[model samples]
Target: MANSRVFLAGLCLVLSAAILVYPSRAVTAAPNSAQPKLVDKDAQESIDKGLKYLANTQRPDGQWYPSGSYGTYPTVMTSLAGLALMAGGSTPESGPYAKNVRRAMHYILRVAEAEKDGLIAGA
Candidate 1:
């Protein structure tokens, strides 16, 4: 309740500020202003490369093998790797790394199914 109240108060303040600035008028884009590109070609290529790397490195069981300091945390690595792939637009049902995503989900589900409380954690 307290959190909601604070959020509402902040939202009201922001809305009031916007009203004061615009005064019920519709805003328009400036003429001749070029539309900003969301991502540059170089940045997009880097993202693609990174996504491919993640997909390639992911094990067939949906787990990522960690090394050195992270070696013991295969669960964490798998979850994070899955999330990164999702962020890069892959889902278990579709997208470039769909098989990997599906395998990851199955791996997590298999672990959770074996646990008493359905928690996905280290064995």
Candidate 2:
């Protein structure tokens, strides 16, 4: 129980730090500039592609990178991926990737429930 609290507290701290360090909008050329428009389009495209990849790779169990080295850290990877989805403006309640977000949440909750210790440790 204590470990779980510590882990969750740490996760919250890291997330808070991330939000403080990275603004939603990237620093780019002036909005009226053609270069900035192109840059924004390219960035959006890259983000779309990345999100699509993540959505496609998600397991039925809602975990990601469930094999190889990453398999050792399923909870961490899942949380990070979920955070990425959220950073992209998707939430469990709404957004383009809402379903994915919910799945991740459910998976995490299930894991937490199954474990006597509340800690979300890697399998």
Candidate 3:
């Protein structure tokens, strides 16, 4: 439960950070905006690298396997990775990572379908 809380907190942080990176398309701000810029080049670069790592590490099954002790947490990893990608401004419908996000969702749905219970614990 503590781990889940931590993970959820981290997810919230990522989602909030994304607001600073990408402004809302639906609601445009005024000319005298307080926060005009997204993220700095360095921060953006770091985000890019992190996103690239996730993209590269994603398996064909749309799951992510962490090294070492956390190897068994593929379901959680995939869920988090998908959320992270969404936080980075990519949706399952469209974005730079649209394909990756879509694939991840597909895998998730597949797992859910196979499980008699709705709990998605693994691939």
Question: Per-candidate TM vs. native?
Answer: 0.65, 0.66, 0.68
Q: lDDT tens digits, residues 24-97, model 1?
A: 43565554648886689999999999989988998877788887773477777777787777677766666788
Off by over 4 Å in 3: 1-38
- Residue 107 lDDT in candidate 1: 64
Ten residues in sequence with the least summed lDDT for candidate 1: 13-22
Error of 2 at 122 (Å): 3.3
How well is each residue in 72-118 modelled by candidate 2, as lDDT tens digits? 77777788888878777776767888898778877777777666776
The number of clashing residue pairs in each candidate reads 0, 0, 0
| Candidate 1 CA-lDDT value | 0.68
**Residue 29 shift from truth in candidate 3, angstroms:** 7.5
Task: Write down the lDDT of every candidate, Cα atoms only.
Answer: 0.68, 0.72, 0.73
lDDT of 2 at 12: 67
Q: Residue 24 error for model 2, in Å?
A: 11
Q: Answer with 1 or 2, whichever has the higher lDDT.
A: 2
TM-score of 2: 0.66
Candidate that would win on lDDT: 3
Worst 10 residues of 2 by lDDT: 28-37
